[model samples]
Target chain A: MSPAEIQQSQNNQLKFLDKPLQADATTDIIYMMCPMHLLTIEEQVREIKAGQVLSILTDYDGALDDIPAWCRKTGNEFLGIYEDTDHYKFYIRKKAPDNKQNV
Target chain B: MKTIYMDHVATNPLHPEVLDAMMPYFREIFGNPQSIYEPGIRAKEAVENARASTAALINAKPKEIIFTSSGAEANNFALKGIAYASRNKGTHIIVSKIEHHSVLNPARFLEKSGFAVTYVPVDKYGTVDPDDVKKAITKETILISVIHASPEIGTIQPVDEIGRIAAEKGIVFHVDAVASAGNIPVDVRSLNVDLLTFAAHQFYGPKGAGALYVKEGTRIVPLIYGGIQEGGRRAGTENVPAIVGMGKAAEIAKRDMQKRIEHVTPLRDRIIDSALKIDKVTLTGHPERRLPGHASFVVEYIEGEAMLLLLAGKGIYSASGSACSSKALKASPVLISIGIPAHLAQGSVVFTLGEGTTGEDIDYFNETFPQVIGRLREISPYAKGWEGAEDPTCTVKK
Candidate 1:
């Protein structure tokens, strides 16, 4: 499938949270567009242990679909996103050592 | 004849040590910082090291510093970045009247873009009253930018007090420190600034390198958007050699700032004192609360360019107000802002000393400057009086 089709399917399955969840680490990439949101998530996730949550803040609309799809592809838990005033907070739980899959 | 360079504020000659530090990056270790190979890894390491050293100069964390191409670029980025980033929060911005063109032009640009900009006034000494800044704050105010020191008039603004007021109001504060940083000790923590702009060339580093200190957690929109360079804030291929030179220069500036101040202050004072002895020559900016190496004045009947030309002939290179005002042949707005008459503003002359400046250079400058003024005034049409043009008009020929 094309990237747009995959994003469409991923958007349908996105979980929205009413409130912010606890995260072991947080990286604010607000106003940074495109691949930065995804690249930052991958870089920040590696620093946290399995079952630890990494929160990414971004203003990019593409992250609404890309992050969740990224979690699905990498076998990590895609936690719900909390919508803020001007941006979104995406939470991802790092997978256990054995459960982690190569992208 | 021996040449003496007194235009340090315009740009400093690159220190030999800085050039030596930057040499390897231009040739053998030339690699894109984003690559994962050996050359690239070395390049990345060098860039990070430079970032750390640059950050250390201002007592900021490495992650908070974003490299730009020049001080003007950094200033533009700070103003436009913060203005755009906080537009949703508020649309009001405040800047001092004596700011550099980089700051003033950006503020003017923002004004045209539906943002409200309040240009706060300065005193006769070109000092911005913190009280005036406090009074200008409105509910819509989201950012306050002020120059740390005026390159034209040599006046240092009370940015710490303004920073306090901004902090109390929860407004983002940015300072254009292109003229002050590296010459003076700048501590971001003590200054209470959210963003500060400075350049490498001002501190004996190569041109085409500058940095903006964005306090951690401050959200700013990208000024140049292309890659993830500079942490996606300022994206362009890093000028590795220039950045390395900047790092070395910053390290040296931090190490030798106090000694430099001690070295140049006396010579600068000598220039000011000698110039003030001439009839109709008035010192500009605060007498004591100014940059250590900076001395500026307005000579009553002569034009700054004529003085600059005559002085250049004597093998003494100096500046006539800021580079913009000098090239444009206009009375500096900074001089006018400080209550100098428009005719007098045309006579604005600025001399900035550096580590290389000696007592003998000051002696030569002091002797030649008064002679230059006398010769210009001898031929000046305004020498007799401004009887017909006594009004504070801005036109030079009027």
Candidate 2:
């Protein structure tokens, strides 16, 4: 394909999230776009202990260093990361278990 | 995912015309410009012609232009050469706080060598006052090096006024015009600069090629010493191909500068306008007296790195103030010097437009940025409860 055709195809691929998932009081997820988003680890942990999962979309450039470190420190289960041209999609599951751990 | 390059200040892709002009030198005309043969003489002529082209773009004589490997090397040559040559007159040098690392790092190197350096502060708009510059000057002050326009903030300094002051004092004045050259009109004579440095890659020329304009009769020593090249001011074999490209790029810039300025200015303003519509977004640097192709803003409560990532993901390539100064960990000294709070400085993004930028690119950024910022803010702890506070200006509704 020509450069213009390649660009057109790339643009056509970047659709927004069709429907954002809902966050109940007990089940929450934090979605963010950068490694600096991991700076709010304490707040994210607070929500996670209350049975929340945090998902972050980050740029691939610097995020490679920050997000895994955040998950390691916070004990949050890093779900996965997906990267498109310039942006990223990240998902993390909360560490907190059910009633036994809560009690 | 169509990439839109908006980081012209960092570097520019080589222009096709410039690349074409440079091709023969690399392959067919591969003789060293310094040799004595006919092919070498032809290569030498190409280098001289390139020198003249670079000189014409900045209103300097061809004889006054010295080609260098990079802007940093040119700056080092200007600072250390003048300091060493004129050390009998003085050891004190004056520079603005908002200078690029190329200028500032060299000043620091001079300071370590027992040269007393005075850093003049800038106002909230990132402009240094001429009066302050004059006041900073003393009998021992030998050189006043300032940046023509900051690469990070895009604020154009009052170099003409500062140059006038330096001239009256008979002190050597140098301006790092790497960020301003080709993007804006720069006449070394009008600015009364004794020395000026600019890089080729910043203006769609090849990298590893730049020029330093040394005003006629300015006394300076060579930064490099080896074979006689660059009029014996800079020594070493010339990168003939890159120099040819730089020369061609300069010719094009000289012809099309006004039109290029007209084309990029509105795109810059549009980006700024779109950014301002989002709540808590503060435009950094001088509003009117700034680089026409530069737009920078600090988005409160959002991390700049994250925003850059999101923007990059969207195929919008730009820079964050935080990442640019990643080694320092401190926010950009330019942003901090201009009185932008550290937190806000961490959230600053710089978008620099160039010749190839289009209205479609601007429209895409305008449409997508707000949504990304809104989405990111929703997950930020600092951004929580920010929406309904008395600080209505700080929050953007989805």
Candidate 3:
């Protein structure tokens, strides 16, 4: 297939895998898929302090240096990360009240 | 919904009539134009007819036309050919700072080969002053090459005035008319150009075909050396089908030039007007003298790649200046040369409309663009202090 055809197929596959979101009061988890470096330190801290777990999906191209540094700076729990074909999914939990001191 | 293609300056879709004229040559009528067979004679006649059509588009004689594979090749031939042919006369050549890579790269190559080149600077609106051209000319200047219209910013150069200056100095004037050929009238006699290059794909014709108009009696060497094709100027078998299509497209453009200009200019204006209404946005290049369907702007504080992605999500296709350059992390040199700051230049986008573009497409862009820019800017740290800051570089003040 042509490059354009392959791009279309990949876009279709991405759309199929992107499940719809439901706003539930019982759960405190928010998901975001963007470049890890795009988020500033302040923005990442604000999201963690909102009493919600944040799951971030990022491409692995240069995330090794950024994600770990972000976790250390914010003192948020870095559950783990898994690599997919061209992207990686990272799970992070909100810090307990004792771990929320400003660094 | 059908895709809205606004990237005509990149390449145009083949005109249906031009394709109809070329279909036969690709199949049963395939023959080398130089052969002695009947099919060969037919192919030769078609090529000659195309030559005439291309020549007429620029008001040049048919014999003066030399077909090439692309605009880059034609530009290479024009610059290298003139530099080699006139090496003894002078080795210095003059060109504008904002020329397309086709002209710029060839000139740079000549520079590396021991030729001296001077790049004339343009104003913030990308207008190359004729006085600068005259002042840059020295006794050792052999050629003065400039773009008729910039492909990226759409500023139409004052070719006629520059032509007069070149004439007084006896310097050979070459205009890269690849961006302006179909949208505007290009009269070689009136422009006084010694050589001109044009690509068919810029005018709703097929890609891989272009023509260089070398005014009669102008002495220039050929870039290729093999068979005696293109009046022994360019060698190798002709691309018959593409040449035929280019010819037909030229004919149609010659006949319908005014109507196409009228149709596209309003769409261009509507898009520009909408863009201007937004805060901290700047239009690049000359306003009144630009191409009819060209609209380029810099939306300050937001990254161009992010804007491009947002527009792509909305099914609105456009191009960022940074994306167009090959492997260059720097912002567009054309934008930078015209005094736009690097931060603002990073937000630049170029939109080129074509024959099929409509008012609805412009409306869609206007409605969708402002919201996207606003969203991207909100997330940007650079945007904090830039609210309502109307820097001199934020708008084209021509």
Model 2 segments more than 4 A misplaced: A1-103, B322-324, B385-398
lDDT per residue for candidate 1 within B82-162, as digits (tens), equals 999999989999998888888888898998999999999999999999999999999999999999988877778888989
Interface RMSD, every prediction, one decimal place: 0.7, 24.8, 28.4
- Candidate 1: clashing pairs of residues: none
Worst 10 residues of 1 chain B by lDDT: B389-398
lDDT of 3 by residue, B175-276 (tens): 999999977999999998999999998888899999899887676777886666875568879999999989999999999999999999999999999999
Clashing pairs in 2: A34-B306, A86-B312, A86-B313, A87-B313
Model 1 residue B347 lDDT score = 84
As for TM-score, the candidate ahead, 1 or 2, is 1
lDDT for residue B384 in candidate 2, whole number 0-100? 53
How do the predictions measure up, each by TM-score? Answer: 0.95, 0.76, 0.76
Which stretches of model 3 miss by more than 4 angstroms?
A1-103, B322-327, B386-398
lDDT scores of the candidates, listed in order:
0.89, 0.80, 0.79
TM-score of chain B in each prediction: 0.97, 0.95, 0.95
Q: Is candidate 1 or candidate 3 better by TM-score?
A: 1
**Candidate number that wins on lDDT, 1 or 2:** 1
Error of 2 at A81 (Å): 76
Q: Best-fitting candidate, measured by lDDT?
A: 1
Query: Residue by residue across A1-103, what tens digits does model 1's lDDT show?
Result: 7785465446446899999999899999999988898888888888889989889999899999899988877877787799999899998878778753753
